[model samples]
Target: MVITYIAGPISGNIDINKQAFLNAADQLQSSGRVVLHSASLPVGLTEPQYMDICFAMIRACNEMVMLPGWRQSTGATAEYYYAKKIGVVVRDFNQTLKVSR
Candidate 1:
Protein backbone atom coordinates (compact mmCIF):
# COMPACT_ATOMS: atom_id res chain seq x y z
CA MET A 1 0.00 0.00 0.00
CA VAL A 2 1.18 3.49 -0.82
CA ILE A 3 1.58 5.99 2.02
CA THR A 4 0.57 9.50 0.99
CA TYR A 5 1.03 12.76 2.90
CA ILE A 6 -1.71 15.38 2.63
CA ALA A 7 -0.23 18.92 2.43
CA GLY A 8 -2.08 22.24 2.54
CA PRO A 9 -2.61 25.49 4.42
CA ILE A 10 -3.20 25.32 8.17
CA SER A 11 -2.73 28.91 9.29
CA GLY A 12 -5.43 30.96 7.54
CA ASN A 13 -9.03 29.84 7.80
CA ILE A 14 -8.01 26.80 9.78
CA ASP A 15 -11.48 25.24 9.67
CA ILE A 16 -11.53 25.26 5.91
CA ASN A 17 -7.96 24.06 5.73
CA LYS A 18 -8.67 21.15 8.06
CA GLN A 19 -11.79 20.19 6.13
CA ALA A 20 -9.84 20.13 2.89
CA PHE A 21 -7.25 17.85 4.42
CA LEU A 22 -9.93 15.52 5.81
CA ASN A 23 -11.76 15.36 2.51
CA ALA A 24 -8.57 14.50 0.66
CA ALA A 25 -7.57 11.95 3.28
CA ASP A 26 -10.96 10.23 2.97
CA GLN A 27 -10.74 10.16 -0.77
CA LEU A 28 -7.21 8.77 -0.77
CA GLN A 29 -8.08 6.13 1.83
CA SER A 30 -11.10 5.06 -0.18
CA SER A 31 -8.70 4.52 -3.05
CA GLY A 32 -6.74 2.09 -0.87
CA ARG A 33 -3.84 4.38 0.03
CA VAL A 34 -2.61 5.12 3.55
CA VAL A 35 -2.83 8.83 4.32
CA LEU A 36 -0.64 10.94 6.60
CA HIS A 37 -2.64 14.08 7.20
CA SER A 38 -0.89 17.11 8.74
CA ALA A 39 -4.22 18.49 9.89
CA SER A 40 -4.34 15.63 12.36
CA LEU A 41 -1.28 17.04 14.12
CA PRO A 42 -1.79 18.78 17.45
CA VAL A 43 -2.18 22.53 17.39
CA GLY A 44 -0.37 25.25 19.47
CA LEU A 45 3.11 24.29 18.38
CA THR A 46 5.41 26.95 16.92
CA GLU A 47 5.61 27.09 13.11
CA PRO A 48 9.12 25.62 13.10
CA GLN A 49 8.06 22.85 15.44
CA TYR A 50 5.05 22.02 13.31
CA MET A 51 7.21 21.94 10.22
CA ASP A 52 9.63 19.63 11.94
CA ILE A 53 6.82 17.19 12.68
CA CYS A 54 5.44 17.48 9.19
CA PHE A 55 8.86 16.93 7.60
CA ALA A 56 9.29 13.73 9.54
CA MET A 57 5.91 12.50 8.39
CA ILE A 58 6.68 13.48 4.81
CA ARG A 59 9.89 11.52 4.90
CA ALA A 60 7.89 8.41 5.76
CA CYS A 61 5.40 8.78 2.94
CA ASN A 62 5.72 7.44 -0.59
CA GLU A 63 3.87 10.35 -2.09
CA MET A 64 2.40 13.77 -1.34
CA VAL A 65 -0.99 15.11 -2.34
CA MET A 66 -1.07 18.89 -2.29
CA LEU A 67 -4.50 20.38 -1.74
CA PRO A 68 -5.86 23.52 -3.33
CA GLY A 69 -4.42 26.73 -1.84
CA TRP A 70 -1.19 24.91 -1.14
CA ARG A 71 0.66 27.53 -3.17
CA GLN A 72 -0.38 30.15 -0.63
CA SER A 73 1.05 28.17 2.27
CA THR A 74 4.71 28.44 3.13
CA GLY A 75 4.70 25.06 4.83
CA ALA A 76 2.97 23.34 1.96
CA THR A 77 5.30 24.91 -0.57
CA ALA A 78 8.28 23.78 1.46
CA GLU A 79 6.83 20.28 1.61
CA TYR A 80 6.43 20.29 -2.14
CA TYR A 81 10.07 21.16 -2.65
CA TYR A 82 11.20 18.69 -0.02
CA ALA A 83 9.16 15.93 -1.63
CA LYS A 84 10.80 16.75 -4.92
CA LYS A 85 14.24 16.84 -3.38
CA ILE A 86 13.68 13.46 -1.74
CA GLY A 87 12.06 11.85 -4.78
CA VAL A 88 8.60 11.36 -3.26
CA VAL A 89 5.91 11.68 -5.90
CA VAL A 90 4.05 14.98 -5.64
CA ARG A 91 0.52 15.23 -6.92
CA ASP A 92 -2.39 17.61 -7.06
CA PHE A 93 -5.21 16.34 -4.85
CA ASN A 94 -7.96 16.66 -7.43
CA GLN A 95 -5.87 15.35 -10.29
CA THR A 96 -4.56 12.41 -8.35
CA LEU A 97 -8.03 11.40 -7.14
CA LYS A 98 -9.46 11.66 -10.60
CA VAL A 99 -6.70 9.51 -12.01
CA SER A 100 -7.08 6.95 -9.24
CA ARG A 101 -10.82 6.77 -9.79
Candidate 2:
Protein backbone atom coordinates (compact mmCIF):
# COMPACT_ATOMS: atom_id res chain seq x y z
CA MET A 1 0.00 0.00 0.00
CA VAL A 2 1.19 3.49 -0.86
CA ILE A 3 1.64 5.83 2.09
CA THR A 4 0.31 9.34 1.46
CA TYR A 5 0.32 12.63 3.33
CA ILE A 6 -2.49 15.19 2.89
CA ALA A 7 -1.57 18.78 2.10
CA GLY A 8 -3.94 21.71 1.69
CA PRO A 9 -4.94 25.20 2.90
CA ILE A 10 -5.63 24.95 6.61
CA SER A 11 -4.82 28.28 8.25
CA GLY A 12 -8.38 29.57 8.26
CA ASN A 13 -11.91 28.25 7.81
CA ILE A 14 -11.37 25.49 10.27
CA ASP A 15 -14.58 23.51 9.89
CA ILE A 16 -14.70 23.54 6.13
CA ASN A 17 -11.00 23.02 5.56
CA LYS A 18 -10.70 20.22 8.09
CA GLN A 19 -13.62 18.46 6.49
CA ALA A 20 -11.97 18.65 3.11
CA PHE A 21 -8.86 17.09 4.59
CA LEU A 22 -10.87 14.34 6.22
CA ASN A 23 -12.74 13.63 3.01
CA ALA A 24 -9.51 13.38 1.09
CA ALA A 25 -8.14 11.03 3.72
CA ASP A 26 -11.25 8.85 3.50
CA GLN A 27 -11.03 8.68 -0.27
CA LEU A 28 -7.40 7.68 -0.17
CA GLN A 29 -7.99 5.12 2.60
CA SER A 30 -10.76 3.50 0.58
CA SER A 31 -8.40 3.22 -2.35
CA GLY A 32 -6.00 1.15 -0.22
CA ARG A 33 -3.48 3.88 0.59
CA VAL A 34 -2.12 4.72 4.01
CA VAL A 35 -2.90 8.38 4.72
CA LEU A 36 -1.10 10.77 7.08
CA HIS A 37 -2.45 14.22 7.90
CA SER A 38 -2.56 16.66 10.77
CA ALA A 39 -6.05 15.71 11.81
CA SER A 40 -5.83 18.08 14.73
CA LEU A 41 -4.49 21.59 14.38
CA PRO A 42 -2.98 22.36 17.74
CA VAL A 43 -4.19 25.45 19.61
CA GLY A 44 -0.85 27.25 19.57
CA LEU A 45 2.20 26.46 17.52
CA THR A 46 4.63 28.51 15.44
CA GLU A 47 4.26 28.21 11.68
CA PRO A 48 7.73 26.79 11.29
CA GLN A 49 7.11 24.25 13.98
CA TYR A 50 3.89 23.15 12.31
CA MET A 51 5.67 23.03 8.99
CA ASP A 52 8.33 20.85 10.53
CA ILE A 53 5.65 18.42 11.59
CA CYS A 54 4.18 18.42 8.11
CA PHE A 55 7.57 17.87 6.55
CA ALA A 56 8.30 15.03 8.93
CA MET A 57 5.06 13.31 7.99
CA ILE A 58 5.83 13.79 4.31
CA ARG A 59 9.20 12.24 4.80
CA ALA A 60 7.64 9.22 6.44
CA CYS A 61 5.20 8.76 3.59
CA ASN A 62 6.11 7.64 0.10
CA GLU A 63 3.56 9.90 -1.57
CA MET A 64 1.51 13.02 -0.96
CA VAL A 65 -2.14 13.74 -1.76
CA MET A 66 -2.68 17.40 -2.52
CA LEU A 67 -6.20 18.46 -1.76
CA PRO A 68 -8.06 21.02 -3.87
CA GLY A 69 -6.85 24.66 -3.74
CA TRP A 70 -3.39 23.55 -2.72
CA ARG A 71 -1.88 26.24 -4.89
CA GLN A 72 -3.48 28.95 -2.79
CA SER A 73 -1.59 27.82 0.27
CA THR A 74 2.05 28.62 0.80
CA GLY A 75 2.47 25.67 3.11
CA ALA A 76 0.90 23.27 0.66
CA THR A 77 3.11 24.56 -2.11
CA ALA A 78 6.14 24.08 0.09
CA GLU A 79 5.05 20.57 0.88
CA TYR A 80 4.62 19.82 -2.82
CA TYR A 81 8.09 21.02 -3.65
CA TYR A 82 9.65 19.27 -0.68
CA ALA A 83 8.05 16.02 -1.75
CA LYS A 84 9.45 16.50 -5.23
CA LYS A 85 12.88 17.27 -3.87
CA ILE A 86 12.78 14.13 -1.77
CA GLY A 87 11.49 11.98 -4.64
CA VAL A 88 8.10 11.35 -3.09
CA VAL A 89 5.24 10.92 -5.52
CA VAL A 90 2.69 13.73 -5.49
CA ARG A 91 -0.92 13.40 -6.65
CA ASP A 92 -3.84 15.76 -6.83
CA PHE A 93 -6.38 13.96 -4.76
CA ASN A 94 -9.47 14.69 -6.80
CA GLN A 95 -7.76 14.24 -10.11
CA THR A 96 -6.16 11.02 -9.04
CA LEU A 97 -9.52 9.66 -7.95
CA LYS A 98 -11.08 10.63 -11.26
CA VAL A 99 -8.40 8.85 -13.24
CA SER A 100 -8.60 5.81 -10.99
CA ARG A 101 -12.33 5.57 -11.52
Candidate 3:
Protein backbone atom coordinates (compact mmCIF):
# COMPACT_ATOMS: atom_id res chain seq x y z
CA MET A 1 0.00 0.00 0.00
CA VAL A 2 1.14 3.51 -0.80
CA ILE A 3 1.84 5.58 2.30
CA THR A 4 0.78 9.20 1.80
CA TYR A 5 1.46 12.15 4.06
CA ILE A 6 -1.26 14.79 4.11
CA ALA A 7 0.26 18.32 4.35
CA GLY A 8 -1.79 21.48 4.85
CA PRO A 9 -2.26 24.62 6.92
CA ILE A 10 -2.90 24.19 10.64
CA SER A 11 -2.21 27.56 12.23
CA GLY A 12 -5.29 29.47 11.21
CA ASN A 13 -8.81 28.19 11.55
CA ILE A 14 -7.65 24.90 13.02
CA ASP A 15 -11.13 23.40 12.98
CA ILE A 16 -11.40 23.92 9.24
CA ASN A 17 -7.93 22.55 8.72
CA LYS A 18 -8.67 19.47 10.79
CA GLN A 19 -11.94 18.84 8.98
CA ALA A 20 -10.32 19.13 5.57
CA PHE A 21 -7.53 16.79 6.56
CA LEU A 22 -10.02 14.31 7.98
CA ASN A 23 -12.17 14.34 4.86
CA ALA A 24 -9.19 13.90 2.56
CA ALA A 25 -7.72 11.17 4.75
CA ASP A 26 -11.02 9.32 4.74
CA GLN A 27 -11.19 9.39 0.97
CA LEU A 28 -7.58 8.30 0.62
CA GLN A 29 -8.07 5.44 3.08
CA SER A 30 -11.20 4.31 1.25
CA SER A 31 -9.02 4.02 -1.84
CA GLY A 32 -6.67 1.71 0.09
CA ARG A 33 -3.79 4.11 0.68
CA VAL A 34 -2.15 4.42 4.10
CA VAL A 35 -2.37 8.02 5.29
CA LEU A 36 -0.30 10.13 7.73
CA HIS A 37 -2.19 13.29 8.45
CA SER A 38 -0.85 15.99 10.80
CA ALA A 39 -4.23 17.05 12.09
CA SER A 40 -3.74 15.09 15.26
CA LEU A 41 -0.31 16.52 16.11
CA PRO A 42 -0.06 17.12 19.83
CA VAL A 43 -1.18 20.57 20.88
CA GLY A 44 1.25 23.14 22.41
CA LEU A 45 4.32 22.12 20.47
CA THR A 46 6.52 24.88 19.02
CA GLU A 47 6.59 25.45 15.27
CA PRO A 48 10.09 24.01 14.94
CA GLN A 49 9.15 21.03 17.05
CA TYR A 50 6.07 20.40 14.97
CA MET A 51 8.06 20.60 11.75
CA ASP A 52 10.63 18.20 13.13
CA ILE A 53 7.93 15.65 13.83
CA CYS A 54 6.19 16.24 10.51
CA PHE A 55 9.42 15.93 8.55
CA ALA A 56 10.13 12.62 10.19
CA MET A 57 6.69 11.40 9.19
CA ILE A 58 7.24 12.66 5.66
CA ARG A 59 10.46 10.76 5.38
CA ALA A 60 8.62 7.61 6.35
CA CYS A 61 5.88 8.07 3.77
CA ASN A 62 6.08 7.04 0.12
CA GLU A 63 4.37 10.19 -1.09
CA MET A 64 2.79 13.45 -0.06
CA VAL A 65 -0.67 14.82 -0.81
CA MET A 66 -0.81 18.59 -0.56
CA LEU A 67 -4.14 20.09 0.30
CA PRO A 68 -5.52 23.35 -1.08
CA GLY A 69 -4.01 26.41 0.66
CA TRP A 70 -0.83 24.50 1.32
CA ARG A 71 1.09 27.21 -0.43
CA GLN A 72 0.06 29.61 2.31
CA SER A 73 1.57 27.43 5.00
CA THR A 74 5.25 27.60 5.85
CA GLY A 75 5.28 24.09 7.27
CA ALA A 76 3.54 22.65 4.25
CA THR A 77 5.92 24.42 1.94
CA ALA A 78 8.87 22.97 3.82
CA GLU A 79 7.37 19.52 3.56
CA TYR A 80 6.84 20.00 -0.16
CA TYR A 81 10.41 21.07 -0.77
CA TYR A 82 11.80 18.35 1.45
CA ALA A 83 9.75 15.73 -0.34
CA LYS A 84 11.06 17.05 -3.64
CA LYS A 85 14.62 17.00 -2.39
CA ILE A 86 14.23 13.38 -1.27
CA GLY A 87 12.41 12.28 -4.44
CA VAL A 88 9.14 11.49 -2.75
CA VAL A 89 6.09 11.74 -4.99
CA VAL A 90 4.09 14.90 -4.38
CA ARG A 91 0.44 15.14 -5.41
CA ASP A 92 -2.37 17.59 -5.07
CA PHE A 93 -5.30 16.50 -2.96
CA ASN A 94 -7.92 17.31 -5.58
CA GLN A 95 -6.01 15.51 -8.29
CA THR A 96 -5.50 12.45 -6.16
CA LEU A 97 -9.17 12.36 -5.25
CA LYS A 98 -10.12 12.74 -8.89
CA VAL A 99 -7.90 9.88 -9.91
CA SER A 100 -9.19 7.68 -7.11
CA ARG A 101 -12.81 8.46 -7.79
Best by TM-score: 1
lDDT for each residue of candidate 1 in 1-101, tens digit (9 for 90 to 100): 79999999988899988988898898899999999977998888998999899999999999999999999999999999999999999999889978998
Model 3: CA > 4 A from native: none
How many clashes show up in model 1?
0
TM-score for each of the candidates: 0.97, 0.91, 0.96
lDDT per residue (tens digit) for residues 1-101 in model 2 = 78989999987787899999988888888888888987566758888988999899999999888888889999999999999999998988877798656
Index of the highest-lDDT prediction: 3
Which lDDT values do the candidates have, in the order given? 0.91, 0.87, 0.92
| lDDT at residue 79 of model 3 (Cα atoms) | 93
Error of 1 at 88 (Å): 0.3
Kindly indicate the candidate among 1 and 3 with the higher lDDT.
3
Clashing pairs in 2: none
**Candidates sorted on TM-score, descending:** 1, 3, 2
Query: How big is the positional error of residue 74 in model 3, measured in Å on the Cα after superposition?
Result: 0.7
Clashing pairs in 3: none
Better by lDDT, candidate 2 or 1: 1
